[model samples]
Target: MKEQSRRLGEDSIGSLMARLSIPAFIGMFVMGMYNIVDTIFVSYGVGPNGVAALSIAFPVQMILMAMAAMFGIGGASIISRSLGAGEQKTANTVFHQVIWLVIFSSLLIAILTFIFIDPLITMFGAPAEIHQMTKEFLEIILLGAVFQSFGMGMNNIVRSEGNAKTAMLTMIISAVINMILNPIFIMGLDMGVRGSALATLIAQAIGAAWLLFYFLSGKSTLSLKGFGLRIDVKLGLRIIAIGFPSFIMMASGSVVTIAVNWMLQIYGGTMAIAAFGVANRIASFAIMPINGVTQGMQPIVGFNYGSKQFGRVSHSVKLGMLVATILSLIAFAVAEIFPAELARIFSSDPVLIAESEEALRIMLLAAPTIGFQIVCGGLYQALGKARISFIISLMRQIICLVPLLLILPNFFGLSGVWYAFPIADFLAFSVCVVILSTTWRKVFRETEMVR
Candidate 1:
């Protein structure tokens, strides 16, 4: 365990990043493929209505994930810094706290979802036509909420412990299981959108079991034995403080999605909503590699910062930004050149395909600058600067995108909905640059003075 922690401080930045980021990249990429493939299967089996239903139900899933991320990412930050400082007991307590947090939170969310399923879907801007389909998918997904929460939260804990390979395998196992079962459930049985939800639930359950075994079987650096179900009040609050930014980022994403759905409904109707769904899925897949890089950077930055290794922290941040920018550039080129071809992967409808193509091209115009903004946000979180991180999180979606979503559609119609994305991206990117520069200077000055 000590050796594993030591590697973050001692290893060459390039080699260490490659070791950490590749598995993370593969894991995230496969997970992204799982989403795309799920959509593809649904598009074929149930058509545009099915796609729109999934889109309406999506914000609920995001809320579930936001809760998981709050516990997972927040706990992982504390665990990484604790381990780096040679405080193994502190790390173990955090790990256990996160587990219980996920359970309680997941159950609360599930019960609330059950109570409000109808109104909730409607509130997310589900048209009357697809309301039932959206409700069916969301209810089944909520059934596995605990499992999904456990798996996602624990996966971040695993990565923080330097078990990146184990973390990678968890995602691969879940995604592969989902991909395999998607067709059998959807097509073989002709079950439609409900089947996709069921397949995802089963996969999440199995993945959570895998992570549980890793900890209980003595393979993990952090143990679950001594720490029962006892919740540490102070520590739990600390975890929430550190992780609040991630929750805001994800939860605000749900808000943005709801706003987008409402706008699409108003301006373009069901077909337009379906097209946005496809375009958004493709855009998400394109940025998965950048997300992977930031995930990889978190532990490295957290550990080094905790240990007072500012140089290593700086290097890791720079390398992460560089790699992410390169990946974003590649995604931009592909999005610009092959929007129509990419849209065709999900559906055969000519009108849907054309709408998706136009949406993709307009939405991703500022894709190249996005990687830097993402890495900058991750860097702040890794350093445990929650206030700044929270601001950065808000910059993109709430501070910039939400307003654009409101105003743009008033003038440009449905096309305005797409225009909101790139405009928000550019605005957010500018803010991140200013914040990162100022913070780095301040951080380095403090380090020099202390020395």
Candidate 2:
């Protein structure tokens, strides 16, 4: 056996979760730091123009995540299964194929975006005047697509190999660089939105390089030594199938952005859209930490499910939900009490601040409930029940959430729009509970892991 593999069943459940969750949580927060930092700067730097451009550009960025999640979630799912079964070699082979796939897919996304960037931004509702600024930011950030894909995809493998510490460090490294460069290029060098894009591109490239080094140097606990040099259709398909839920979930992010932007423009004009942007930025910032907690749970859930340690699987799922709920509630309180204060952090306009605060408070009140919906959904994913997970995410995001975001705002004006969040969460949680219960009984309860 390669030396980095975990000793056969050596750690206690508390020990293992403690070891993993700390780093995973930290990494998730760090992972989002630069994005949030630049977002704050852009919102204030060029006033509403920069923030709106960023809002328009944000969906494109999300698509990149969807692509990464496609392979990352897929590859990591299989890798965790392999590890639980004590098959490092199989895990290695899968990792190799996934890396090469990342490179190819990322390059393809970049080229397509470059060719179609303008029309896409316009399609998202960018006005004729802000078109040039939006295009510039998109062009610059799009250059980093390959690196973002590589780094994001590989980070999942790093964690799956039980090197959650290393994965966390990798994100911290990239985030620090992004933070340092963002101010220098944007303010010191006066690059504006272009600067933000350049800084991000360079930082992601460094992260991708770090991931490459970890595997090639024979230091990764799980190595892709002799596998995935070339793509295998069968292997790739399995990865995608498991990952498809994440893709749909993330793709739904785009859908929400479109609907919200179009509604905000009609009901409240640019101020409303900008206010929506503020709420999203703060919400995403808070959710980043919640996502970390869920990520920590994924492998634990996966390993236990694969080992048929049903009780451990159940415990971890519950723990994840508890943590997510608690954190989200705290965030909701902060946003609700000081919505204007939160908005002031991004911009100084009183009108924007007031509108944003109401939107932020309304958006966040139901956010704590998101913890249950996500972790419950993730429990299904960790068990490789992608279809169930996908349905919950689809209905939550598309079926219930989108409709609320559109219809609610019309009746209550801006406040109605903001209140759409918790309403959707309330509905989605019930749906998620049904899926969780069914999958738990049908899959985990009835099946036994094959030795």
lDDT of 2 by residue, 172-220 (tens): 8889898899888888888888988998899998988888888889887
Worst 10-residue lDDT window, candidate 1: 442-451
Instruction: Kindly list the per-residue Cα lDDT of model 1 for residues 299-387, writing each as its tens digit.
Output: 99988877888888888988999999999999999999999999999999999999999999999999999999889888888888889
Q: Which 10 residues in a row give candidate 2 its minimum summed lDDT?
A: 1-10
Query: Which runs in model 2 stand beyond 4 Å of their true positions?
Result: 1-9, 227-229, 449-451
lDDT of 1 at 152: 91
lDDT per prediction?
A: 0.92, 0.79
Q: What's the residue-level lDDT of 342 in candidate 1? A: 97
Q: Candidate 1: global Cα-lDDT?
A: 0.92
Q: Which predicted model would earn the best lDDT? A: 1
Q: Which stretches of candidate 1 lie over 4 Å from their true place?
A: 447-451
